[model samples]
Target: MSVWAAVLALIIERVWGYPDRVYRILSHPVVWMGWVIGKGDETFNKPDETSFETGRLVGAVCLGAFLALVLVVTQPVARLFSALPGGWVFEAAVASSFLAQKSLGEAVARVAAALREGPIEAAREAVSHIVGRDTAGLDEAEISRAAIETLAENASDGVVAPLFYLVLFGLPGIAVYKAINTADSMIGHTSDRYRAFGWAAAKLDDVANFIPARLTALLIALAARWIPGAVPGGALRTARRDSIRHASPNAGWPEAALAGALGFGLGGPRAYKGEVLDLPAMGDGRRELDADDIDRALTLYRRLLDVLLGATVACAVVVWVV
Candidate 1:
């Protein structure tokens, strides 16, 4: 069943993330998706060639077709796998590629480690790999905050959202979510070239993530109860009070929760593309964060994954029995 497949996929991802040598050989599922999306951009998204409305219309149609194509391929494959004995395990391995538990955690853990022992530039460089914001001028606190924010937001985007879809619709569901999320990342931007051409991808990705974002906030709040020095109530309270005030519809939920749980202030005035964005601060806690805060965040994230895995197993049992 799909529920059990979700459990196996989580365990597999936690134990062994996509290996580097394998990535060298196969690149990644997202990379392949990115290639197709790039082709779409190149063929039709001509800024000077097409009008704004034309671009929007074309993007919408292309997005619809891309999603349709994903479902067409993945749905049949899922059915074929279900027909074979122990095939769900093979499907689980395929599904594991869609999860980012180890990858995101390892990346954030490296940032924390670099911040603790390495030079300021090392810390900045590590943080830059995860966040899109300008890291050149970041101080210790800003760098630490950026790292934690990325871990928190990606806990939802990279892990929770994909798993959510996997549980609901098996391999096909997860494939569709990843395709949309990848399309959004590749082309969904506010730049002059992307603003109109990527409208559908941007909006659809938001719609897909809406529930999972809040669910991640709730899960973080739950996991915070078990993490030493984390405040579950504060996480819940801040998420409720400040999540909507964030610049993005979904990112604020988990960011505010993590900030409150760790008693650190985050998300206030960051530079992007050399332009300063005076974003609203998430939690009203201590503004001066250090490497220790990043460590606490990593611990919380690990604990959250444990909680998520246990819940997935429980759901699998329920689905099997029913």
Candidate 2:
């Protein structure tokens, strides 16, 4: 099952790639579904004296329900669509929709372009898409730094993690992972409202992403060596050491590698809403970050895409021959 999923995913990526219109159409359903689920969770998200065990139980139930829906409901629906004259096309569309190779690059590139054109204002706008920071007062350097950090983190979350699950368990796995990730993003936090109940979602997401995030960092480091001006040697060392420094056990690896590759630092002192929180920095040395650094980061991002695509092909070949 895993091997077939990998082959199908690679075939879809190579043949159709990710057309913007296709993504727009497919993402609409996921986004709307996410919004509806998010609203329901919010409504039921009252602060109660729930035990940690209860929270874990609730999370388990929720996850089980999601899996059942995807396997029993969604897969049948996909097969129904596949029964059409061009059913395989619909299946490919569904598979491609879940993958984020193109979307990630385009999102990061937009930020880089925005920064290049308008400096601080451009950066402020771009930062909103990528980071959870107060961008209104951030200078050019801060905005660029935030964008780079987002690029690295999302490389794992948005791209590699989903693909990893898809390869392991097919569309059902990807759907469940996305649902859990969405739940975490919406309610998984240490705040008073979610500190207890959201623990399962947060912890599960952490577990799911653990290996993928580290793999993403290694791929990024390899990409740095391939790019013209990136410092792969230092980037590799910094990624290993600083990956555990950031508040997130997983996010730090990629961000630290990206920071070191570009000769800048990231992940220190961010403002959420209006409150400032002091966070540990990712890279060893601090250098001034600017639009040019963002460009370099994008270069590395593109290379990472290539690396991932090549890996997928290799995996597919191995599966086919075996």
Candidate 3:
């Protein structure tokens, strides 16, 4: 049943996405999670008031509280749906709201479109929405690199990771993953205010992402094999060699796979806020990224989604039969 639910959710997300009207009325689960995290930060993350251990304790409590809240609400709802006729459809639609396959692709496509038709500033503005890096001083190549890198990395975060958890523990699994991801995005940083308090969120998110990130890279490599022009640069070898060089343990996997697939080098010395960090590059191919590269990345991402859909269908069939 859960396997079928995942398939239905993916289909809904790929076809219509979450509608703007529905969003206007209900906002999003992630937005609500963000609000909870924001309030927790405002209440518990005071720099002068709390010590590092205290901050860590508070973050743990907050994480626990949020997880409990989600389980409490969603479990009953899942039970309710299970009692009704074809109720998995409603449950699947709810699950689809948490997955961002179409939205991620569209957002990345907008960056590519902006780069192709607008000024460099416009492109920078478009990419900034999806990435955390400083985009103000980026050139065209840098801007394109940032956008493509985000596309690759978020293929894990926004899509694969949630689906991975869904298959393991159903809706509750994906919900908890999203909550942790939201908290990490809100507070997981090395800045003075967040260094202590965000540790738990950051570490927890890393653990949650560990398996799914590698799976995403594997899917990308598979897509490259079948999808023409997807990985002209040798994704498997490049990923094996350079993936560990990234600042993040998980983000590097997909990024390396993508860089290898696109026949380009990504990463290496990007700015966050105003600070430039000297990071290692991923691939040994082209460093001169362009709008066309963004398009290519999107193409690969779409193919990867098809791969995921196929996998979901096969898994669902097995589960139903068995």
Measured by lDDT, the strongest candidate is 1
Error of 2 at 263 (Å): 1.9
- Predictions in order: lDDT: 0.92, 0.74, 0.88
Worst 10 residues of 1 by lDDT: 287-296
C-alpha displacement of 196 in model 3, angstroms?
1.5
Candidate 3 structure quality by residue, lDDT tens digits, 148-222: 898999999999999998888888888889988988999988788988888888999999999999899889888
Order by TM-score, highest first: 1, 3, 2
Q: For residues 192-268, write the lDDT of model 1, one tens digit per residue.
A: 99999999999999999999999999999999989988899999999999998997899899999998898889889
Over 4 Å off in model 1, which ranges?
none
Report the lDDT tens digits of candidate 2 across residue range 1-322: 4445555664576455676685576654457457755654565455575666676566556555654665775577555754677554555556656666666666767776787788567668867876777889988778878888888998898778877877776666677677777767866788877776677778888988899998988888888878886788778889888887788989998899888887778888989889999998888666568777877888898888778877876876787788
- Give TM per candidate: 0.98, 0.87, 0.97
TM-score of 2: 0.87
Worst 10 residues of 2 by lDDT: 1-10
> Clash number for model 1?
0
For each predicted model, how many residue pairs clash, with residues at least 3 apart or on different chains?
0, 0, 0
Query: What is the alpha-carbon lDDT of model 2 when measured against the actual structure?
Result: 0.74
Give the Cα error of residue 96 in candidate 3, in Å. Answer: 0.4
What's the true lDDT of residue 201 in model 1?
A: 96
